[model samples]
Target chain A: MNARRLAEEIFVPHRLVMIAVAIGLLVWAGMAMRWHWIPRYYDLALQGLWRTIWLLGLSCLFGFMLAVPLGLAQAAGPRILAAPARAFCTVIRGTPILLQLWLIYYGIGSLFPQFPWIRESELWPYLRQAWPYALLALTLSFAGYEGEVMRGAFKSVPGGQLEAARSMGMGRFAIFRRIWFPQALQRALPTLGGETVLQLKATPLVATITVIDIYAVSSRVRQDTFIIYEPLLLLALIYLVIAGALALAFKLLEQRFNRGMVG
Target chain B: MLDWLYALWPGLETSVGLLSLQPPGWGGNLLRGAVASLQIALGAFALGLVIGTFGALGKLHGGPVTRDLLSVYTVVVRAVPELILILILYYAGTDLLNQALQAMGRRPVEISGVVAGIAVLGIVQGAYATEVLRGAIQSVPRGQLEAARAYGMGSVQVLRRVTFPAMLPLALPGLSNLWLIATKDTALLAIVGFSELTLETRQAAGSTRAYFTFFLAAGAIYLTMTLVSARLFNWIEARYRRGQVRQ
Candidate 1:
């Protein structure tokens, strides 16, 4: 085992000196960088952070749920079902999410007003807002990427297990639920975590549509103060923390499923 | 007969005109944007590969301090979203450059958007590329390197003969993925006001108020790029994998 060597590689005097330099820079930034804008914008930043979390959480949940059906369609369904699912996945994955967001927000959002029923409907207010389109775009994009992952996961589940369940007189649906789905779910869980972080990184795109996510809050501060680096440096640091936390949460979830087993 | 069909869907004529390639139409602008996007992607990808080669070498062979610095660079770049990173690099890089110029008593010069776009996106791509290339290099069998050394080959000669050849087939898949990503990430530059495909689509959609038509067209252009790139990479990967045992 090269564990000792790795430890030595990481813990040398050179690394220590570098770490000291890093700490020094952090201290200088903390003391010297602009701090005056925090009090005025702290509340907005909080709200924006909450909005970002909401977008990431909701989109990922709904998207993964949608992905199951899509994956199933591709992995096992008839030609008719598989064709549309494949096309949908390809189209969504092929283009930038920014274009899709704009298409929904600017293109379809503008189309809604021409119809009297849409304007007069009870759900009109929520439909009129930008967040719904943002949510739809993010959810669809996540689903598109996850669907391909799930397809491989579903296919990787051993066929013999399904046959054994069938031999036990289980119905098709029961075999899928009890035998196939669980194995596939476990297989897919590892990739799903990284995908979720990707989904988190993508949440900032919704801000383009006027949904005030944390990235938007940073952009606002920059525009307001005409001070560029401070807000952006802070933004980068904040994202780093969130990304770390997200990765940790996923690792914990994986460990729970892992039952202390590791590779 | 055609008149009746046109009357049945009145919006069709308007859409056709708006999307047409003539003077009144904005198709030219969108085409220009697509060309610009392709240029930026190519430039950025080349720059990224250059940086990635050094980064991978530094990580594999450099001192602990160098490794730590490289780790920090990759970690920070990977942690933040591309959009935020683009903003920070675009603004801060220009700001710092001008400041340095002032200190040198030289006049401040504007960084062209194309050059800036390439530099920022290339740096971002380099981080991911470093990881990919490092993994590829590590996968190359150590025995081959030892044999090369036994043949009286120096480190550089061994790298040229045994290492890079072994690494290429392994690295091709990831490098191709990075290429696709570089192409797509050019769209993010639109957010920073770069005149890329997305911005042009938006402008076309806004001016004509035919949003659906223009966006759909732009999406088609992007889809074509993706499909074409996918096929091209598949061919390249196939060529590199020639005579290798199938996994």
Candidate 2:
């Protein structure tokens, strides 16, 4: 990426001082910062990190699955489907996801036990758990945001490709699977990556619902140990690392997508 | 609570009763929370815009150290989640201030939640706003800046009269998006037990056993704010866009 050359080009004298100051701060943090609690919480922190990752991954997967139909409905469906789809995206996008999370978890979660069949069902135990409600809210929130992105992606697809597919005897579903969906997905991929990081940021909201993700664990650490800065700083570093890796992965994915397409 | 209101309008007995502005009804509390949310959002947005303008300008026109420092701030703030940032910033900020006060032999003052919330969200908003404004400022036609200089205006004068206004139209959409983000981000303060709309709704719904009602009402309030803000931004954009190049 020519990072070395670029850094050399931009390395003015004051910038050097800035770099040195940053390094010094890190060193001070390492040498002088608190550390007595790490051994106790590290195990739980790891588990919390795992929970956060899975919540991010599964919800994004499920959400994108939901978004495809929502996007398609908004882009090309009849008024009946499109209006409701549009309304869903608008309402979801407008409100805070924290509100939505509480709505699903507390609002709908409280309602479930009121029904006799829900209590009697085999899935009742899972439904009674907090993670499912967390998952549901996260999934719906993702679907809402991505639905708008996908709508733009769908609308932006070259009309000629669809016309050509139709002339070649491709049915609507076949055309969608082959040319339409792929192109839309490729177009949506960049925004999808950015939104995924936002989803990662949002995974912490489950903590509010008592789902014990990484942020929740950190908060618990603070409550128990009466230490605040160390845990939160660690949490920030973890998030930064994950966000960086995710960014790099998306960059590679974008490169691959570009490679498969002829110029 | 809503005897007069119900008398004025029939068949709204239950749902309307839940939202009455009088005692035993939480509608007034929710509205107060909405006002608090708006205050925070508005204060944060203005503060962020100020920081963003400077950050963007520094990135664009300042020295290498300034650019690098601003970039670091933006990147770090953007990568981390706001909830974590709020937690860290809210406490750390207040603690640092008190320590500074103690060092100066002054008694530490309690930091108000609204002010702290504004400052924390403002910092977050500033990062996003910087990116938006930097792009917007860059989108200003270079020729316009040159022309202002051509007219014998000093650097500050050029920025005041030409660069800022020239960039407004291009920057409006991104800035507006950030405003909406600011409003939504205030809900994160609910974690810190700030009395914002989301937390207020939770308390109301918790007490009432009417979770769907209060939460949905809060949602509607947020939605309305967003739509209204969109309209307001559009009007501001149109106002600034008089007699400009259209394409």
Candidate 3:
């Protein structure tokens, strides 16, 4: 065999064997816990993972919806609209997400019961829960950062193209719908993906407020088992897999968006 | 309607009433926390710059193995939650060190929360800085470096005189953003019980059940710091671009 092929054969087997051993060790740990704890830790982790996913999904969805108008205002006409939106973005982006989460959960939450209308309202039940406050904080955080990104993306869409659309008898909103939004979104996809990953990371802070997300579950399991590294390592691995999947999906979407555009 | 709006404002209670001059030392406690947060962020930012510069340089000029390792570090750091990494690193670092000490028949060493916090923040910040600095380094014209080398300057000299200065302007925006992130990441250290702003706010709020007061104070302090730093970074950027023609 040639030298390169020989080197590959020698190196490749060791990597595969290492991978097998790691997986084996991981399985052994889980099985050990399952037998010792009566499947308790496993159940908790699964539930936590699900909660984290749903939390991330809802916050990102609503945040995106909120961001669109805020972002448009940032890049579109009047100073009145842009100024407040800019300030909103600044304050949100400037502070820590954890602080915001706490402010919403403990800060605003304590105040909710004091208001007669809010206390008597149907939505108060949900608002009183930690999850809603978590959701509120996460949604606002996402909108703030993502709104700025979308604003930058909006400004990046060439003015010439907008002028061309205008000359073609397109109404302002029509031009935005047809030309501005898509192009801006396409360009912003990569940054948005990073922000989404950040949003996923931010979900764990909700755990601090007793939301029972993945991080909270792992922390609980760790406290119970007195096995800190394994649960935390497993948590990291789960996040890695999710982030990898997101990065790959973004790449595919980016390629699809750029298909006809000249390099 | 005005009354209703006012009622929604939490009624100047202890929690949201810090500015009303009721609580004796509550505001002082939060201000101290903000200062601690700033100190931690500044330390972490310095460490991050060093780590980022080296990582960027390694990625730029090192062999395939070095590049691959740095790439893995960036990817993993970027992917994982900061909270998870901090907790793991804090616990595992102490554990591993204690194990090593036992092996060597030496006394075990405890890692301080402050040291651990700075180290973790620096590490994560380095991953992002590496990417930012790498781009900045790439943006510096190849011709400038080539000319420096042709003048018989050593590699280190070329980097010092040409590469670092040229990349500063390009790197400023990303670096400043990283600084902001570093400041914010200090709050994460509070989870590990570091007595930064957020943790202090939590303590104050919990003790007094005045959640809105302490946190609002904390948030406003953080906002002030952010704004001040934003202006500082902007001024630095302007200084960097002084001689260059605006596009």
lDDT of 2 by residue, A1-263 (tens): 69998988658678677778989998998889897898988899899999999999999999999999999999999999999999999999999999999999998999998999999999998998999999999999999999999999999999999999999999999999999999999999999999999999999999999999999898998999898898899899999999999999999998888886887
Instruction: Tell me the whole-model lDDT of each prediction, alpha carbons only.
Output: 0.90, 0.93, 0.87
Considering lDDT, which of the candidate structures 2 and 3 is the better prediction for this target? Answer: 2
The CAPRI classification for model 1 reads as medium
Tens-place lDDT digits, model 1, residues B138-200: 999899999999999999999899899889989988998898889888999988888999999
Off by over 4 Å in 1: A1-12, A260-263, B1-10
Candidate 2 deviant stretches above 4 angstroms: A1-17, A260-263, B1-12
* lDDT of each residue in A1-263, candidate 1, tens digit only: 58989887768788778778889999999898888999999999999999999999999999999999999999999999999999999999889889999999998899899999999999899998999999999999999999998899999988898989989999989988898888788888888987887788888888888999999999899899987888888888888898899889888877776684457
TM-score against native, each model:
0.95, 0.95, 0.90
Candidate 1 DockQ score?
A: 0.79
Interface RMSD of candidate 3, in Å, is 1.9
lDDT of 2 at A102: 96
Off by over 4 Å in 3: A1-38, B1-23
For model 2, how does the per-residue alpha-carbon lDDT over B147-199 read when each residue is reduced to its tens digit?
88999999999988998888889999999999999999999999999999999
User: What TM-score, to 2 decimals, does candidate 1 have?
Assistant: 0.95
lDDT of 2: 0.93
